[model samples]
Target: MRDSLSLWFIVKNYRIRSVFIKNFFIILSLILLPVTGFSVGIYQLYSKTVTEEISSAHLHSLSRIRDMIDMTIREADNYSIRIASSETLATLMSPSPMHNYDLNVNVLKMSAELNMMDTMRNFVESVYVYSEQNRSVISSQMGRWDLEQFLDQGWLDSYNTNKSQRKAWTVARKAKTFQSESEEKTLITLFRLAPLLETSKLGSVIINIDTARFMNMINQTGSDYIDSVFIIGGDGTILGSNDLTLINRPISDVIPVKDIAEGKPNEPVFVYEDESKQSVSYVHSLYNDWKFVSIAPLKLYEDKAKYIRNYLYISSLFSIVVALIISLVVSWRMYMPIKQIMSVVSRPGEWLEESPPPKRVNEIKYITSSILDSYGEKRELENELRYRLSLLDRAYAIALQSQINPHFLYNTLETINWQAIRLSGGENVVSDMISSLSQLLRFSLEGEDNLVPIRVEIEHCKHYIDIQKIRYPRKVDVQWHLDEKIMNYKIPRITLQPLIENSIYHGIRPMSQEGMITISGQLEGDSIVIRVADNGVGADPDKIERINQELADKNWITANNHIGIRNVNQRIKLTFGDQYGLHMASVPGHGTTVTVRISAIQA
Candidate 1:
């Protein structure tokens, strides 16, 4: 007997220890293995990825600037061609005979046309036609000037020198405007000879483009990573730039262009350092043989790389700690089922009522017995639940049967109403009252519908008001001013009649003079509002405030007073949402208005 006991102790101890050891290593391996591998190589991978992304972003910005410049140049060339081919310029340039009045009119017309063209583009400073043969220049701003008197005759020299060039874009130069008092603005001119089909023309059409505006366009694309943007010509000259001072200067004078010149022609983008040790990104434009360059600080990229390295280190440390904690949690979760089985075996009195587990039983066999016992308990509970549900279904059916009385009452009222109308044979107050009451009963019996159309609700409300008017006999008046469009929209059924009844009982019946009641409804945004107002005896301001508070109360159903108003408010909220309901306003001796707000739901 002692040998058997010792063997049982050894087997129990070995089973527990083996389970813990096996599960600990298995969970730890699944979690820590991936974390360990990730920690070793992630830093280098992140650094290379970030660097490539930054470089690609810089290259993209350069390309955008190039496209903008190319588009602007194209627009200027198109405008130049349009002005040259205009019939006004053509008639002015022809050597046909004309009177002084016609010549004056043509010159004025050409000046107006030039002025219109100048205002059409933000970058175009001025547009003008110069007639070298006529020795007269008609500018958009300065009007007509003789060849010698023109302030910008410098272009004529180039025009005469380059006679073979039909159209050409001149380099940037300071242009003197007609208003000499104004500051001189630097501009680039596009010169197109007139009479486009002819080898030679009588005059030239020149469009002046503002260089400052070009700088503004380039500066708009600048960000923290970019320092300077430049448009450099193929001959190493800076044609346009964000820095106005650098315009028309040699590219080598501002920054090192040697590396760019040495770059392979097939490569569209390249990065290099300038004299100030700043990194510059260059993009070569195949459209115009120009280079778009953006300068950035090398320290920025290095700082970003350093940040990535530090972040990776911190993340690796955190992941290692989290992995250890997760492994512990997984081992504990796996051990819980075994622990539960032991607890069940120890206390077999709960589920195993007939045949309890033996004290020295095997754990696997005891667990199997516990599962079978629990399944038997579950089946008993399911059977009891089904029996209770059957009782509930019968109770619900009994409640449905209770609605028959209201339906019977509505049918009986309809029959009596028609009989009274037939016996009267003509317009009788008793017959009309019975008809209205019967209609009211019919509307009230429609309990299956949660919502009814506004038109139907209004008709039901009118029936109630009609009966009240007969009882009061000209002592009360009810008016309706509802919108025709909102008639098709829906509201909670039997909502408006209760408020009308409340208005007559509480507001108008106590007054000595004739009382006025107004029912108005209209759509306001996404909601519909209907107000029932009476001008008879109003409540005290404090009492009105309390009634309004009760209308807004969330637990209004439990209150005793103002049952009609509270019921309507609660129904609106339950049907639509808490955001919709009723409100009340009144003065002590004047009147009260109960307003109903509901969502604009279509039937």
Candidate 2:
């Protein structure tokens, strides 16, 4: 009893069934999107929050680092100012002849100034005064060290900047003087240009700070999340790095310099994410073309939000699952009527695939009735189209038969020509005329096929022109420039004969002078071109254009006589393709040239 009741409910009228299911689904969908979308939206919001936090934190830490870097550079600049202003150091470095006592006095004066400068700054490992005048190296600690041991000639050229008087930075190099073999010390040099005093040379001052100390000062300002820190010098090389191993490496080696150059300058921080490494960056421009770039792992900040996302996801999953189950139950109930309708639609000629029939409703009956009516109308239309097409085929056959029938006309012509040949008593003109006439009739009545070999087609045209020759004698002449090699190519039967006829009646007959027709053939790559041009009374340019337009456009309004040219054009195109057709070219008082183009298909 319960099974019967359930069946009855399912097989209820379609209008009521569709309305109930549609409203139910509408309510169900309204419930599902918000719940699912809210969960996803919440997750995205949290993700954005996490990204912003990392970026904010990155900029903040770099700001601190920037402050520290600025302080160090300012202090170094102050040191440079002091060194530049030293009168005793300047006088000692200036060019002069130095005897033993004079050299000693000058050396002592330079040493005292360096010692004072050294006491004022703690970061400087040593300050060297390279003098061009005396060609000597002077330092704060050692009065004189071998110039080669402390500073190479290469260092002079390597660190030379275009501009002078400003402090310049260099990539880390092996500390020249103070280093133990157990731990190699790398130094980043800061060079201060010694000012010119009375056009005397004071050379320059070089300050070397151990790279470990220089990088430490920059790294210490950043937060614990920072994965790597770099100090890139103006020369595009890494000057100092927290990872001592990366010192002296070009900025291009870590990140593409092109990417850096094109980066948004106004962006507080730049984030680079890839499979190999993910990090947020902060770039702070320092004085003298130095950039402090810090890359901190993005995963660190992302991990901070992971637990929150996971907990929220777990909570939302249960609600989605419950809603999904409810949706499935409602959707399954809605699918029955839709499935039945689709079964009929997917197959065009067939209707139902069921063995035991399902119950039908008034809506189903109406739909089936409408579909049957449409199907019946389509069948009737198809039958009518077939009937009309059959009539068209018969009409074409009758028309073709009228042109070249093997019965009454062709047979009678052949009989008369044979009689004339027999009775001519070896008269060449009568025999030749009968021979051409009989051959032309036979060629015409040969078969129903449209295409014929080029030789056969040419012979047919020659035959037709021969008959015209008998009528007019030397009034018209045909100049054949056909290439014997391409003479075997197949073209539409009767193709050339009609074109020659048009030239004669329309062109040659209208002119006062003797008419000449030129027919030529050549292999033009993949196509055959046959020209039937006449030296007849030329046509008006505008009339020629109108005729060409009509021939070009099949649907153009045209007179009955234009049909021959238009038919030839359409036939060639239909036989070969649209690319091959007839073209008419003419000039006033010159002539008209009608060229037939078709595929060069040799038999």
Candidate 3:
């Protein structure tokens, strides 16, 4: 009989161990998996958000640079028009009807006046008159020159043929005085007819412009980001440039000919890579068919974006690592008492049952003596009742662990309130936070039922949703569906709040686009099922499986936020037996859903 009793005792202890292991696994799944997932998700989200912001800023900078180039080209075109329409040129070409004697004296005086006007203009490098009759060139600087040896037939033909048509022609060539081998140095000349009279055709006006001076004016109006600007003629010849060395080179040799040819009439052409393989060029063509090109190195802008991305990644990674370390340390500290209790419970069955009862201290003896004197024989019985009541109260209190510290909650709410006031008071976020806080606090402090009415649970969820909505207004959406018959059923207080908080803070917050959180409850057979789902970053299968394994092994207490699901599970098992509890299912990108099962309570 004694052997049989011992066998029975061993079996009972083994059964208890099995139950503890099962409970451990269930609790682990509810807590650790969500915490780890939340941390990683938030980190990735922060990284992506910072990356997109930097990219947008880079694009804006590129657009501004393009606008600056356009403005510079426009300014250059206006200057060209001004020189073409100068009143001095018109006066010099006016008709002299009489074939007068003293023609040299009159012509000399007119030439001197024209020279003086050219000096005052500053932009004109040289002003000359070409006489077709004498084949002589007279200039302000070069006094007299015979055009026979110096003027090319191509230039003379273009000038003589187009003179009657009154069409101006421009040409780019090495400056007549150039002494250097530098490729960029060159000169541009504008040629037009100066009709001496209606009856007599004598000569034309030739204007030579200093290309460097023209480029300087263009450069002054352009952005500092431009490395160089080019002035290319219609025939793909480099007329002038900010870079002097490129002045006389053919455009086809320096830039791709296809690019300039294929470019739109007025629209700028953006080439990603140039001859140097380092810069990007934006090219625009003037009405005169000269190409205005701005070259800026791509490295200048790309470096900025790269720096920002690197800095953001490093900072986010460091922050997450530090936060995780701190959380682990703090959680371990907070979990000490519960860990001690678990350790005591996990000891060998024989050792626990054989342990001596705690000895009464001097204070307890004195309290007992006082009670005995005051109540006589009834003191012993009343003392036992008081002890049992105290034990019951302690056990019940352990069922609910406040989601956030009271001080933290109050401070956060206070901050939200002030921010809401500043945000122009219209259904402001602070009001929502305060309402959520009030509901959460009321449920924590006054809803003493192990199973609260379903209506109260729904209100708690709504309040939590309101606070999250305020924090992430554009990112999180909440939906609620409830069955009328399940309204009166009771649930453990503070049970669903953590799940909702996890959904918002971990799930919805990580998504770049807006996300939704759903809370739905319905009656199915004899049980009511409540589901909270979020269209957020969902759980990893490997992690979920690992957490399940940890739960099965009763190692979940080693994980983060030990009190959340474990405490709720314990309360449910103690109040309504082991059949009712929480269940979770998830898929990546799609979302996570948590379901709580409870027996429907009759009104």
Candidate 4:
């Protein structure tokens, strides 16, 4: 018994230790995959990936911030438009009060007019209506008053200055005492003229949004990656910011906005820096003529990735520890079965060699009884594997057959193409059709791979367009706006053919006179967007919207009608992620534009 125990410890214990060490090494190697791929020798490539991801995240957050700002500005503009267009406000703001006896009625009417802005639920610090003719201010806090005491000289100079546009966006400042300290809050004011039919000078309306409240809204909407948010003018005049010190200061030329006015409106300007340096991203608001700048240290941009990396490291460590324990357990379990066989081997040789009945004990019986039918069982497994391979091969062959059938058409077309060359010197109509048909077929069924170069897809489209132009030679004209730089980027095969086909069939052919189909490609942000537009009788707005909805959902129930477009949309999504796909914008009488969105990436 002591001998058996000693042997068990010596043999089984060593096996457990050996297996544990081997498995731990394997697991540690596997845990280091992310590190080897990006963390170690490929540090520069990993940095670029991290930077792009961070920039994209910042851009997305900036979009949301822009939306919130646009919405806020729109609400203010709407309020001004509403007040300007109102007949009641026009009557109240006239050169003279309309009624002298109806003082109470006028008060009630003005009070009710003031209360209209309250219902909007926006963060309005105060509302004021100032009459420039009389130099009088009618505020929500203080009713109608004919005085210049409400505003300081500096405040009045900025407001009356010709700097801001029709919608004057004033920097937040502590104006002189108007009504009370209760009404005072460091505020940015928006000024709009009360709309009138005649050229008679009336007053302007002032809507103030608290600087703190505005910045709070900005902070809440902005992602953690945005370290600072700024609302500045074209000349770098700081209109608003979370930091009060930055609020009135001139923007440093280091973060330039001088050429922002020259830049096309709505385009974002981005500046990036190293890990220790600050990065700045800004967008110009066409409505208010103010640019919003979001600045952050580069490390903040990678903070989320840093957290994820740390988490992965901790998880790998924990997994390696757990794998060590599991390997020991598994090694011990395996040894039990082997130990039973070893016992049989050590027993009397003649009895062991006998073909014996199974023992009742599970470990001994399980080890001994399975050996007799091992060859038959191996044969059965081999047959099952063969059956599976046969089915897979047949399925693969059927798929190849489907793709191969298109080649038969290509072969016949090639023969006709050669015959056309013999008949008409390869320049006649049939020759063109055969050549186009062959190219189209090859493009459509070239290989199992879905992606092809943009140049190839463009050529495929041009070939299809050539066939269409021949069918209606007098009416159709094609213009190419291919960007040479993006031609090598891979797009799903035959992507533009369906779009061009739709433009020809549904769009151009429907129009009466000569129609033009324009195909354009350009880099819009990080995406390579290709647009197909036709000056044809466009589809009804309702139908266009329905088609767009269907494309978005990829719910192609009827394969017969929109199969080509459906396939293109699905292929675009499959090749690039779900965020990239087809979009449609159309005008009822003018034309329809189909947009194909693909991520611009190297093959």
Residues 188-257 of candidate 3 have per-residue lDDT tens digits of 6667555422344456666666677766765665554566667667767677786667766776667664
Q: Give per-residue CA lDDT, model 4, range 231-271, as digits (tens).
A: 87656667788876566677664465444445543333455
The alpha-carbon deviation from the true structure for residue 443 of candidate 4, after best TM-score superposition, in angstroms, is 99
Between candidates 1 and 3, the TM-score winner: 1
* TM-score of candidate 3 relative to the true fold: 0.37
| Candidate 3 lowest-lDDT run of ten | 551-560
What overall lDDT goes with each candidate model? 0.73, 0.69, 0.59, 0.69
Best by TM-score: 2
What tens digits encode model 2's per-residue C-alpha lDDT throughout 1-603?
A: 234223345447454465445655675777777987887888888877876777677767876777777777677666765765677567666665658787778778877767675433555666677775566777877786556666434346644542253444444676555434455567777666665343433577767676777666666656875767777776767877877787788877876535444465324444456643345464656655677777767776567567767877787788767776776577666665555455445442465323223366477655654565576677788997897577557546655656654456667766776777678755467667767877877786677787888998998999989988997777789999998888888998778888888888878887777799999888888988888898877789889888777667633322343337776786676688767888888876677899888898977
TM-score rank order = 2, 1, 4, 3
* Candidate 3 regions with alpha-carbon error over 4 angstroms: 1-101, 116-120, 149-166, 177-185, 196-203, 248-252, 255-261, 264-287, 297-310, 323-603
RMSD, every candidate, angstroms: 36.9, 25.9, 37.8, 45.5
* Tens digit of per-residue lDDT, candidate 1, span 8-93: 44346666465654686777777777776775557667755665566666667666777877777777766777778878787777
